[model samples]
Target: MTTARRKPYGVKGAPYAFLLPATVLFSSFFALPIGYAVWLSFHKVHVFGLGLGKGARSEVWAGVENYTDALTDSELLDGALRVLGYGCIVVPVMLGLALLFALMLDAEKVRLAPFTRLAIFLPYAVPGVVAALLWGFLYLPDVSPFSFVLEKLGLPQPDLLDGGPLYLALSNIAVWGGTGFNMIVIYTSLRAVPAEVYEAAKLDGATPLQIALRIKIPMVASSLVLTFFFSIIATLQVFNEPTTLKPLTNSVSTTWSPLMKVYRDAFGTGDIHQAAAEAVIIALATLVLSFGFLRAANRRDKQEAAG
Candidate 1:
């Protein structure tokens, strides 16, 4: 047998060289900040008598004090509950609409498929802040066309900015912005499915709805899981949409979400240590929930395959 030929000089280092920039950027932007935040999370500042002077405030080890306070804070807990409620509305509605639209797009002889898809997807191109601002204007009784029409029809114009309506209003914004992107994801997955499978189903007397429910949906389960995973993460980190809406309504408090509470602690109250702890907690929760979901999905997939 002939000896294996040696690779060219520096060949072993080529992949590392190519990855060097990305690695450096990741460490600089993501890893370093996370590490620093974790370090800050376990520490607190001690103020000297004057609360003003050189070394007046010094960092000191606080163990889990910051975390304990964060856990006990009613504001943080309330924010988390609000987010959970919002997510309960958002994730299901958004993903359902997305799946529905994708199915409709895939159906035969659908009218205006291209235009409809484009119209549904156009909102994705708009920045979240701008979208919230636009929607915010539309929510105003004085400015909204819906309100204008309600006035013309002599119907009551309810406030969309407060109370139970506020949750729906916020959820609608998220659903509208998210559905199109998710539709694209599911539709792309649907298109990748082998045409032969559908043809075989058709030959076996499967109707469009039957095929969609039985065959198409199953094939795109992976896409659904992916969208769900992302939707959860997005729901948990909801900030910009609600933040943008803040100027338009008084109902949206500064601590509308856990992430928002963290922001309030960090910049609003000048409590970096507490903020860091809250941030770390949110990050950990996100990771735990995300991995737990992924594992469940994987286990289900394995079970199906085994069957």
Candidate 2:
């Protein structure tokens, strides 16, 4: 027999209906938090005389006071500069190693490729906090393998957890923890290059380096751009690594990085308003930098295509 007739717009309703749950979840977790942070950014607490009663401590509208304070705060500025330096080291080194490893994997007669790939990617499975903890301990002179070898050879053991080396020390953790994931991304795209393309390049008497530099790299440019975009964001949002390392090192202040400073302000100092302003600033910076990178990459791709 008989079947019920569907509504005319039911076809359209079906997709949105399926997406409703995800939309709700995204709103709840991401959108609401952002909105609330923004709302809190424009308010502050009021303290009357005596400051000892519930009525004495009241919430009041701050009127951009928090934003002004955040912008002028030397600690926040220092944290931002520190993070910039850290990101400068992390982004290039991680992406470079990723591209290098990916190209190596794409090479002929590569040994232990499957095993090497799995090994390299294994760290990606580790949580960033856990990875930082593991690497933090390894940076300790008494516990580090490098320091152990140096000690055996009667050489001076340098402190990795402090001073100028602190940048590289923090950077190494980010690089090690991130390289594997970026490598796999670049390698997967590298593998997707057409076999015919390589054959054509070979027919033209191009060496492997030429094929990679000219063909594979060009073909994989989109993937490189995507990876670099994500890597830059990750470098900017570097909180877990530096925060985890703080317990073991003194150089890392309560405001070591911008995100860490936000965390400290919001939770540590119980000032969500100032933190919110800083958070919004960071989010904007991320969007600007990421969009700029994508445009630059696209321009290069177009140039390559035209040439």
Candidate 3:
């Protein structure tokens, strides 16, 4: 007790050693790329002498000019609107189907539960591009079995790749791919409820529907919130499906979504600075919307608990 005790070397350094790999990877992949994007967002290419050669073009500080232009860009705004509409359809339908399937799987009398779950979840295993291509072929009038059946039945074949139906077409792909994952999350949550809780509900004369609505749903609220959070983020970042379907239809433009516009700006037009600015804006929007939703959910939970 007279002298301060020294910690063992291994114990003292163990935490840091454990964290080193994660820190390095995060710095290399996430931190560096984000930092570079922020830096690029604040700069632009200054061209001189007819802008002909590499030496004539140089990087210069742009301040908020890039941001200003991005915020006002009509294409970006339109893309954002399109994505918002797409999200409206995808979020509700996907989550609803997921919840429905999870509840069904949790039912006592459900048959072939494992096979049914696997069948629903299998689409998520397919790559987004492949899923889109598969759906794209099915949407085509010349190749689709659905279209052929409709033609034989004398029903008008709706154009799924253009106009209003295009939204449904894209939303279906997202729902098909996403619903299974969300279902599994909710189903796991459902499984975690203590058996005694269900017994107590049954003793209180609660029917299966009542037990599900009052007990199971409330207990699994946290999982629902989590799935909703992820669904929102995914909806905001929709790119792969639309991009994959672009070659099959004229309705999907290069700027069909915000991320698509970023791709077009950065690579299509070789305007990296503007692209970076737009990318930052999208990131900020995503963060703001995501956090705002989380805050609202937390507040509602607090209110419900108080009641």
Model 1 stretches with alpha carbons more than 4 Å out: 1-8
Candidate 3 residue-wise lDDT, 1-307, digit = tens: 4988998769978999999999999999999999999999999999998999668989999999999999999999999999999999999999999998999899898999999999999999999999999999999999999999999999999999999999999999999999999999999999999999999989999999998899988999999999999999999899999999999999999999999999999999999999999999999999999999999999999999899
Cα error of candidate 3 at position 105, Å: 0.7
Model 3 TM-score, 2 decimals: 0.96
Clashing pairs in 2: none
Error of 2 at 259 (Å): 1.1
Is candidate 1 or 2 superior in lDDT? 1
Off by over 4 Å in 3: 1-8
Ten-residue segment with the worst summed lDDT in candidate 3? 1-10
- Each candidate's lDDT (Cα)? 0.95, 0.89, 0.95
User: Candidate 1's residue-wise lDDT over 1-307, tens digit each?
Assistant: 8999988999989999999999999999999999999999999999999889898989999999999999999999999999999999999999999999999999889999999999989888888988899899999999999999999999999999988899999998999899999999999999999899999999999999999999999999999999999999999999988898888889999998898999999999999999999999999999999999999999999999999
lDDT of 1 at 154: 98
RMSD for each model, in Å, please?
A: 2.2, 2.5, 2.0
Per-residue lDDT of 217 in model 2: 85
